[model samples]
Target: MRIFVCIKQVPDTETKIKLMPDGSGIDEGGVKWIMNPYDEFAVEEALKLKQTAGDATVTVISVGPKKRVADALRTAMAMGADDGIVIDCENSLDSFTTAKALAAAIKKEPACDFVFSGKLAIDDNAGSVSQYLAEFLEIPHVTVVSGFEASSGKYVVTREVEGGTKEIFELTGPAVVAANKGLNTPRYASLPGIMKAKKKPLSELNLSDLGLSSSDAKVSFTNFELPPEKPPVKFIDGDPAAQAKELVRLLKDEAKVL
Candidate 1:
């Protein structure tokens, strides 16, 4: 069996984001990049599946600038993926275009038995790529998956839904699964694995190579800006009854919640 895991390079969660001067996008300077945390779960699940299958190969794929995204792919290799492919596109693309590029890249390789990815990327939180990718590939897909098992040539998975319940599915053919947190514990890259990852095969492709272009983007972002700063807190000074009256007055006249 062959498994493919899709990942993204994103600003570290703790990093303080700054907008570009012209409000076109976030400023990339001095930003720390890491693999999307949810994608790590996808990679870990893929590795676990490969280990169980024993004859399976896991390949990592990402779409971004080669310099940065290659690091994410290498991290996956260090975590035991066999090799990786980088779809080298420097500009940020919409979820549609990104999924289209990924599907095209997958088609250029040997037929894969399954595709895995994060439920959503942290940067945009659009949570739509996996669905778009599945549509582009003409395969079944389950998103926000928190459980998985395989038997009788079928995949049994559970996805979290509204009301704290989980929906179960059994897929008998190739499909895409977007992993959520708590599915598995992602392993850290050991020193030896990191060193060995330097030698693993890493291939690159461009948008044109995938029969896509910037014009394919269905959405465009502009006028990026931070949220307005919150106003300072005000204190109501008096005894308990007076305070209550003042609070009610403030809510009704100033805050307007009541």
Candidate 2:
């Protein structure tokens, strides 16, 4: 069995975010990018499956630009993926176009029995690419996957819904699942794995090579802008009973919650 895990490059969670002078998007300059968190879970899950399904091979694919996307690929390899493919998109893709690009890559590669991706890219937070890619590839797609089990050429997926509801889906091979957080514990890249990762092959392909065009990406962003700062918070301090009374009064009168 062969599995394709799609990963994305995103801003590090701790990286101080600044808007690019206008409100459209993030300021890329001086920003450090990391793997999309949910993608890590997807990678972890793929690695787990490969371990269970002996003779299975796992491939990590990312659409991005870098002097080298090696760093991201290295991370995946260190986690046990066999090979990597990089689509040189860098900062020029939107959700719709990216999904198409990945679908093209998946088609070219062939032998992909399953595809896994994070539920959303952290920086953009547009959680539509995985579903779109499934659509583009003409395969079943499901999101927010909390648990999954694969066998008999089919997969049973568990997910959470609004208001604490639960949903389950059964999809066959070649389907795509957008993994949710907590799917698995992501392993840290060890010294041995990191060293081996450096030796792993990382192939870079251009947009034309993937048959994806920047023009197909419709959204236009002039620049980024910071959201308005919130006013300072006020606290009411007193004994427990006094605080409870104050809270009740505030909720009823001050906040007009009556």
Which is the leading candidate under lDDT? 1
Residue-level lDDT tens digits of model 2 in 37-112: 9999999989888877778889998887855455787799998788898888657488888888888888887588
Question: How large is the C-alpha RMSD of every model relative to the true structure?
Answer: 2.2, 1.8
Cα distance off (Å), candidate 1, residue 55: 0.4
lDDT of 1 by residue, 80-104 (tens): 8999999998776889999999999
Return the lDDT, model 1, position 34. Answer: 95
Q: How many pairs of residues collide in each model?
A: 0, 5
Instruction: Show where candidate 1 strays beyond 4 Å.
Output: 235-258
lDDT of each: 0.93, 0.84
TM-score of each: 0.92, 0.93
Ten contiguous residues minimizing lDDT sum, candidate 2: 218-227
